[model samples]
Target: MNNFFEVENVDFVVGGNTKVKNMSFSIEKEGDIVCLLGPSGIGKTTILRAIAGLEKIKNGHIKLKGKILSSEKINIEPENRNISLAFQENSLFPHYSVEKNILLGAEKNPDNKDKKVSFNEIVDLLDISKILNQYPHQISAGEAQRASLARSLLSKPDLLLLDEPLSNVDQSQKEDIQEKIKKLLAKLKITTIIVTHDSYEAFLLRY
Candidate 1:
């Protein structure tokens, strides 16, 4: 049997600089959560981008469920990869309400309508139901982060990538939010790879 997901001997280059080199990792089963822990500028985000098909890898291969996603001779478009990436920065459309932004993700696959997570469930878990009508500019950084996360989760992707997922959360609520997210992921059983600089966060969400 093939591994669920694999990144082997990958190298990333940008602007004539080598960002990452010889990186290799694998997720052996579905619903496994893997954390890529490192400091800023160390290419953690780059790795996520590469896996998501947002960036090209200069060497090696990325395979999902035994299908090649990226390689020297082939690069799949991001939309065709069945992967959702929650960016480190809030990326909601400026003119769209929070609810609309989240809905966009689910709209990607009409055939998976019944499989999508309930809107209310995610908003309630992220505590963003009250701000459904609010735009991204009107919410706090933490709120925006949660909204982005909600969108990603609603997409029902085969693989989920979260970049600094809780970086903007307030200190008092950070731990609580973390616990809620952990439980939510477990309940959903979505295969995930989280990128973060926090060791504690990595440990809490570790496979």
Candidate 2:
């Protein structure tokens, strides 16, 4: 019954319109994957953004592991929250190769650098080893999505928010990628929330 992540009565407004109102939810356990299923423009992505500190919550609070991240009176900067949000849009640095992009935001602490997973290990886990030397523009959509996902994972966030993560993945590769990602996240014991429109995928993930 201990909640590790909590969103309490969060309200987000855009241009005088309430995009997200009175929303409350919690993730109670480490490595628990929660899927938000709803139609587009229903504030699902907005909720994720609010939790990650990308969007300001007009009312109420967001907390992770008992640390306050967002509230009406106080807001932590996105970078300091230690939460990584992978958008539906490809966020890769165009000039960086896939290998460089994935490692760009990794933890820089020298003390535990050896403990972190290596570039080769992540690329292999995401099944993106073959495209490591290629640029963002040189890769396919599915490949770019995989690389972006890898980049988010490399940051070693306390919480991970994925917005329609598998949208661009090929249908044939979707299930396999999902399984790999699910297994990897479980192994890392990272609390994650994934936003997707497909109910079937959500059911599969939640089950």
Residue-level lDDT of model 2, residues 1-207, one tens digit each, is 558999899888665578988988999987789999999989888888878887788888888998888998999998788788988888899999998898785743224342355567678877899998999999998899889999888776778899999899888888977887787787777789999999977876662
Q: After superposition, how far is residue 133 of candidate 1 from its true place, in Å?
A: 0.7
Tell me the TM-score of model 2: 0.92
Q: State every prediction's TM-score relative to the real structure.
A: 0.95, 0.92
lDDT of candidate 2 at residue 84, scale 0 to 100 = 87
> Which stretches of model 1 miss by more than 4 angstroms?
113-116
State the displacement of the C-alpha of residue 158, model 1, in Å, after optimal TM-score superposition. Answer: 0.6
Highest lDDT model number: 1
Give the best candidate by TM-score. Answer: 1
